[model samples]
Target chain A: MTREPDSHYSSGNEAVIGWDIGGANLKAVRLSREGLQVVQQPFAVWQRRDELAEALARIAAELGPAPCAAVTITAELSDAFRTKRDGITFILDALQSALPETELKIFGLDGKFHHPAKAYQQPMLVAAANWLATALLVARDLADCLLVDIGSTTTDITPIGGGKVLAEGRNDPERLVRGELLYTGASRTPICALVQRVPLWGGWCPVAAELFATTQDAHLLLGHLPAEQCASPSADGRPATPEYALERLARVVCADTELLSQAEVQAIAQYIANEQIHQIAGAMTQVLSRVKVVGPVAAVGAGAFLAEAAAARLGLDYLRPATLARGAASVAAPAVAVALLLNEEACV
Target chain B: MTREPDSHYSSGNEAVIGWDIGGANLKAVRLSREGLQVVQQPFAVWQRRDELAEALARIAAELGPAPCAAVTITAELSDAFRTKRDGITFILDALQSALPETELKIFGLDGKFHHPAKAYQQPMLVAAANWLATALLVARDLADCLLVDIGSTTTDITPIGGGKVLAEGRNDPERLVRGELLYTGASRTPICALVQRVPLWGGWCPVAAELFATTQDAHLLLGHLPAEQCASPSADGRPATPEYALERLARVVCADTELLSQAEVQAIAQYIANEQIHQIAGAMTQVLSRVKVVGPVAAVGAGAFLAEAAAARLGLDYLRPATLARGAASVAAPAVAVALLLNEEACV
Candidate 1:
């Protein structure tokens, strides 16, 4: 769906657009003097990476033309391509093909933008830098805060202090080890990956190793996510309804509705949700202990509620990205952040 | 490929065919006065469960019909069906349709064969009982021993003592929690699931959560599995060759062949193989500590070499399933075991 920016952020500066291309979704934000406009689409790049240029062309057309475009990418980590270099080069080529006239600047982990040629030369710099873009925008408002941006497939826990991004890791692999990046998220994570054993029948019941269900089922059953937010496909190829969700969850324990009562299935769902929170909180605790950032946690992305809950568990104050980028832009924080950064630089 | 049993175990009784229907493959063994014969085919029941009857029919024609048919199944645990009951009922129906004239008996955890109608009533008893079938066969030869069966997708560690099966858990869920069932195997398991971080560049680099490479690639590259033994499809659908396996393994760390030397990629393979052995040994330690069995480890299945290594690490002597069932029948131990059991019962 297309989300037009509010008229308040409109200034008499040249229009710019930002793109946060991820493995599962494509998010774009247009910041013009008329206001900020945001558009996000669920694109399974791994399956249809060949058509990425067409998908981008459609979104670019809807968002209209701009003189310059700012881009940050985590799609390079998708298994669709062999390496980050292949993914980065393919995405940059798609962007160029889709928006041939625009001056494209690739966002890097150093919190700066580079030419597409430079991005191709050193792809790791542009690989998975979407978190840094959002952190840069958050740092402008709050000098010392933990930025927790949880998207559909991953979570980024970056520490911001002294109006600078205090991230110990510069890339995804390093970030994962340092507890600055968590593979768990709101919707796309396989439920089996989150918990090896779930509570059932007053005992610990191990789950099937297969991808029988996903976190989308857990969050949907628990009402943590609205129906529209479950953009990913269900594990069973069924609709994202509560009944099918319960059916999918039942398979996790090698049981079915005939064996497990609705209440029993709902309890499993609750356990799964609780386990997700527990894991996210554990990672946050690790990061907080290491970074020693004593400030409110600014939660962003579509899974901001999960981040906020994680923050509460650690007895830390919580802030919203809306304090900086209001409305739908908050959910598409990385895209909006890059647009704003490029806009400010253009104005200068 | 169809594997005919050698003429060594021929006896004067009505022939009985045993079947072990797993999620990833179908195995069948026939025992008669003429001899014993074994045939295993890679049939992804999860993807084409409807064609199970057809696949069984083709195999049955090759092995010839028997007076009675015995069956033990783990295919019902596949996500292709909603629950174990569904998987059990579907597989039973396939067997009935494929061998309409043969008397069909379902093998259960109790080490006995029940009528198909009775099996439907007690589905869990018949679900995932293949390991039990093999254990019963082992108990006849070695009264006190640990049964380690490592297949394409899972490993089962069942302890037998006093010529009796002493299993603490009968079902997959319980077995998983008790350390008797390890979801990791020599092949089919995603490398990311075996270890979250792999040793790379003299440091631990976290792997991408996607199914970029599987244990099949690691085993195939390290020569643990011959190309012919890799019956399952590769992660990238590439041919089961060392060169392609290396390419797939490189992607485990978000690198490519150009970025990593062949030696570096081989090191990752060695690490994955070691971690798998370490995990199996850890589980064996848990089982031994609880059950207090001082016997040797009887390793079987397509991944028997892996089980042998794990057994050695725990300071236990190793035995082969061939001690009980000779030739190709050892690799298809459960199938051969059930066929022999049914043949003995029918003769009486």
Candidate 2:
């Protein structure tokens, strides 16, 4: 579950660990003089919230306890807490527990870093702010570029120009309206949310609005994601095997294996995948039209292929975050960015 | 508090009590040869789910317990239960405890009544199915009509033609996509849901997507609902008074009375109300266009005003359910419908 440090990892000196704690996953990056050491764990926080401190301890152990920690979180949006404030406080408390002696800085929505006390005061800023860190890092590399970070449950499309994050939205709803934020993501999104109708045998059929299948199922069937990670059904509470995924997708159209063959299911997945791409492409177009700079789009996240497809569809130049940085750092860009920012500030 | 029944002089010879158990309110009707006697109590089931048996017992005591009881429920959709099945079983258990000796007939979505065990077998049919009973009752009287039943949290639009219920959707999601169901309701629906844009001094401004005010506030500000009833903050979590409602509504637009006068706030409320009507009116138009029979629209539920306005907009005859039946029965049509059905079935 943990990727140990490579040979290039610097000694404990000038070392910083970054954390992107989400509802379903805990990702960490340790940035040293040599390179980025990343660790990812599939932790459904809601199910085992009490074990958060323990999970953090495990990730921290992987990084070998860096001098300072830079943490950003979206897990506060989960229902484990009554309010965002509670989620933020709980997450911060866990971070404090994970690194009791180390200096910790939390990334805020205002594009600044804050101490735990200050971050706790403005819980909204500290909550779900990993996107800002990634955008900030991307802005550093390419002053004029579009940052497309699509994860499991959401998408962040930020315009970076003149070494500044040109974002019209500060909060989730505002971002959603301004096309800087999209609720649709590559994985965990229910297939019903992608399209109203699906192309069946020869005609278009209206889809059943049930949680029978998700975008993960579509992407899995299409071989976009590794079969092992194709569909981690933390919420679906079902086996995440391809056979089970087939059954789940078939049920979406009110069919079963007996009625629908694998080819038919694959066709459904393709139609769904195409619609999802169109969704992101539409949002990308909106943001692209509003901006004055003709910058290339930077595709990032576990769902980076979506951004690549979207940029290609728009006939815009595409830049991979992995090309700009290491694959682990690119996939876990926010964590790496925050860690770099912290390291640079400490050196200053 | 349970409202005691008046002495309309119906001894127990042919009396039958019908129940409509919603998540927030419990409405009951005692039907006899004289008339339909209704009693209502505000019982928040989610707050104290275990007290459901006790709450039902109190309500049944108000009606003095008839020999036969017919029940329809929408509370199964509440979050008190793990699933609709669990909710149905819990509700059935509560009803059994409340009326242990009474011959019970539970209304099912299949347009028929079933015994407790039979109804439990088909939990989905028993869940949020009070509307079907009312629609079926209305269908018997007026074969061709569009039924608009709006409650505190949701609305149901059913098409009745050829003396049968004609619906494009059966469940909530299906009904939602088919336009037969709308999550927007009279009392508890957040104002932000009604309209995205609201009238400012001269221009339309997007309202803050916050739960500052609900539809109850708009209705209260317009003087449609009485002040006593207007201030029912059971679910709204704020004082429902005109003065308080004004403050709450002002918050929706991120304004205050000093900055945006009472007239402006009133306009906002009016704008929201108009948009809500337009929403239902639009749905009515969609359903009306598909049906061949040109029938009068039956307006029921507390939000019947919206239906009346919708009927006026469509230039169709508006028939008040209250006029067709008792005043209380019309207001709580599902309970009345079930009571009538129970009374008829008792004779058989």
Candidate 3:
């Protein structure tokens, strides 16, 4: 694993924070003379978008204050807003209102931070740029590598070569076509989205196309994720424990624990987890085939373990998120990347 | 079209009602001296299972009380209950409370009706027996055929041969394996469940796994269903119109109308509609390969048109629901079947 260089936050410049405001999560990282401080919160933007400003205010209060903050966002893709332009404007408005004293810089697809006004005029350039932020940060260190950042709901397989981000798709739609974005993730993806049928009771049982269970349940049951780290809400609105997850997972095949033994449910979980890994691996292979100078895969985020599994399946070496960010900040790599990038600018 | 025999409701017997209680719909039909009275209501059982008793009572009040009510239910498959037994018990309790003076007979997989106690003891027998109720009714007329009943959220493909319900699988799980129960429906199924990617902007773009849109939007936009018939809630909580449907369809690819033209959105809807038909057709082929004496395909329910399309695609003769029931009764075939079957038993 390649370790990141020391903090670029010089003592002479005031500390600047970074925020990656996603549809389902809010990640904030503050870089100062002391060290890196991270705050991660789960906020359902699509359901409770009206509460975003208040949530942002609460995060701002917890992180104290900074003179400026750099922001990369995927929240613009949330269905709460009619269009990304509207989402970008709403988020920028909320950011300004929540952090009235701090200046805000919006990270764009071009790997540059622009003033809020410029972002408003060219919202598409800044929409869903969180992946770019992490990729740009990884590009700074690795001359050639693939950054496989798997979040709660989506995976970003960004390729970096020659110390530059070489992503062919600039937008989500294009990225999806190029296999750079695989919608299935470790937590939020519905089990039915991964596979239509699961091997059960000596037969392949078709799964219910409902949100009966998510990858969180499968991962939680299979020990890929702990109870605490199962951040997404249970599909059945039950507790996030393995017992409840097993019930939810059983329902994916329209059965309950009463009908299915624990061993059977565990097998189902294992199958789902394996299929999820295979899905990521398939996408990674498609991505790797296109990029020149294939390097080690940098697995990062809440689903970094899934990325590593995918990397292993492809017989490729993998790097942990700690190679780029430390501790919880590694899971919040985009937030840390923006903070570090902003800090470097301040020093320059 | 093979027409069904005249109603066997001998005026001597007291009026009988039949209820097909589904997870998303409550379809009630009354067979009295004055012909058939059908009532269909949308009730989200998974979200509000506790209100089921009240809903049943309200429907009873609307249809008026009967001496006896024969019921077939698919609501037991809802995740609201821990097990099918629990669901059956709860539904029976609701029925008893809703009609204290009425005699209740539960439809079973044995092509017979049993007392509520029998259903409670062997809930699996009556868990999803609505399909059987319809099949038995069709079996009375057609000696050999496939009963393709496509509701809002699921499609049941039951084969009947030699005037018997020759279904390979009894319950939902088993039926799924035998290609007798397809989870895809006409309206409520999430679009992502149908296909992982859609042809968009000269490329195949991955669809968002989120419930941003459903089959209702595709069928609505494609004119397969009228706006008033879109009983399911819109995925974006927008109006059930082609305009808003286009918006929702675009979001499946993480784009909006701003990025996608109406023609493009319509193309996407067309693709989804065609794929849904292909899915049913594929299942129909798998099912047909197993059964002997393959006969006409009787298309019924809200998605009878879809079933008809599937039948045509397989180059098989198709019969409309009207072949067995009339008017709206065709859409509420299960309810109508239970009513006719119970009425016949009453006459005997």
Candidate 4:
């Protein structure tokens, strides 16, 4: 991973799509001369690699027409490709193929944008480096603060100080060792993984070892997440309603309405949520242990609730990324951040 | 919830298929006057209600031909039907349509064999009654013992004494309360649901909430399960290899090989397995709290290892049904048990 000087951080004017693509899903933000739009879509790349171009076309269609695009991807780590180089080459080829003759640029680990040919040459600089875009953007707003972005399937934690990215590890594996990354998230997590035992009939009972319930169920039951925000193809392939969530959570302990009361299931959901908060907090603590918080912690991504809870537990101030990007935009912060950066580059 | 006496347990002679139909899968055993055969197949009844008839026919064909059939069902609990009665009627109709003029007898909760007419009149008695068939067959060998049958997605623990089923809870709700049943299993169960945090590099980390891995992975890594023993639609839809398992289990802690070593993931798997056993043991202890174990515990089902571990933890003698049925036959103990009973009745 390389760090670059900001001498080229100038301004130009045009529309740009800041794309943050990952193994299981895709997120993007379109910033035109008119305005900006942030979007997130689920795309199981490993299951169907061919449809990715179609998905991008659809997302772009939703964002309206654009002649310029900048991309940062984590999807390269997916087993669909043989190596990081293969993944980056494939992604670049996808962009070149889908938007021929369009001005396409890739975000590099060195903090600059590159044409596809150049980006492909240093694949390591472009492999799964989207988080840096968000961190770099956050550094512009606040110095000496921790950033937590929890998506549906994973969480990214990074530290920035003195208007600079200070992450010890710029790569996924390094971030994990330093506690700046965790795989847990707000949704899609099976509840059984959060805790072994749950309160049942006045005693703690072990949860079932099935995909009967997920973090989405817990969040839905607790009223922290809206129905529309729930992941489709839910844990049970049923609607992510509180009722269905109750059914799902009950299965964690191997029960149904016939066997467990709604109240008992509710208790189990609460227990899971608490354990999840603690899990996130543990990672956050590991990252923030050395540095004392002087200001609010930035909470971005779909699972901001977990970050908020972790910050509270640590007695650190918590700031929602939505305060700057707003609802859907915050959910797709990295994409939006890149879009903003690209727009700035265009303005010059 | 009813128990039948031996007066109706007469002998006859014919080939019989003992069918245990569940909401998501089917387990069947064909018992001829001479020998026995056990089989299992996945059938998501809810997703394809109309295909139930075809599924049964296919399963029967796999077992060759049968002159008579004794059926025990749990598929009624599936939402495919509005009520247990509807599920029973649907299943019976499917059986009749698939096997015209074939002698069909349904196992009622009362422990008596009922003609379709009688079984249809009160569907509740015939719903999810396979457990009784297994317990009754076990009673023939050890009247005073606990039957722990761990399947792919559930575990059934029943108490038998004095040559009769002594479970206080006849229905699912009652059974859940008495710790006589658990939804945890050995293969299909998601590993995340088994534990909140797994032991890792000198510490504990929350397992990935995704379907990144399953108990099958732990067992695979530990060498207790063969690759062939893995479920077809694996927890992550990947090959059931130790290497892939490492990738899956590492995700539990949100790490990849980059951040974690192979040794670390192996530890995580071992930790998950231990926690899963403890979970089963906890439930087992709750159920046996009020009883004195005078004989060996009957350990059956796909997850019998978990039950066996729990039994060893509790200092009880654990008996593998394979000792009585052997190999795959033990995996389908309930199916085999009912088939044996059906063959005896067919002889009479």
Q: Report RMSD (Å) for each prediction in the order shown.
A: 3.3, 6.5, 3.6, 5.9
Better of 2 and 3 by lDDT: 3
lDDT of 3 by residue, B1-348 (tens): 112323533224678888999988898877777667778888989899989999899888888768889999988777787777888899999999988988898898888898888888888888888888898888878888889988899999989898888888887777888899999888889988788889987878888989899999999998999998887888878889988898889889988888888999999999999999999999998888898646899888889999999999989998874445465677788888888788778523
lDDT of 2 by residue, A258-277 (tens): 54689988898899889889
The best candidate by TM-score is 3
- Give the per-residue lDDT digits (tens) of candidate 1, residues B163-228: 888889877767776778888777788776677677776776666656778899999999999888
Please write out the lDDT profile of model 1 over residues A89-140, one tens digit for every residue.
9999999999998999889988889999999999988988988888888898
Ten-residue region with minimum lDDT total, candidate 3 chain A: A1-10
User: TM-score of chain B, candidate 1?
Assistant: 0.96
Worst 10 residues of 4 chain A by lDDT: A1-10
Worst 10 residues of 1 chain A by lDDT: A321-330
Query: What overall lDDT goes with each candidate model?
Result: 0.83, 0.73, 0.85, 0.74
| Cα DockQ of the candidate 4 complex | 0.29
- How many residue pairs clash (N, CA or C atoms closer than 3 angstroms) in each of the candidate models, in the order given? 3, 0, 0, 24
Where does candidate 1 clash, by residue pair?
Answer: A5-A36, A5-A37, B5-B37
Residue pairs with clashing backbones, model 2: none
lDDT, candidate 4, equals 0.74
TM-score of chain B of each: 0.96, 0.91, 0.94, 0.89
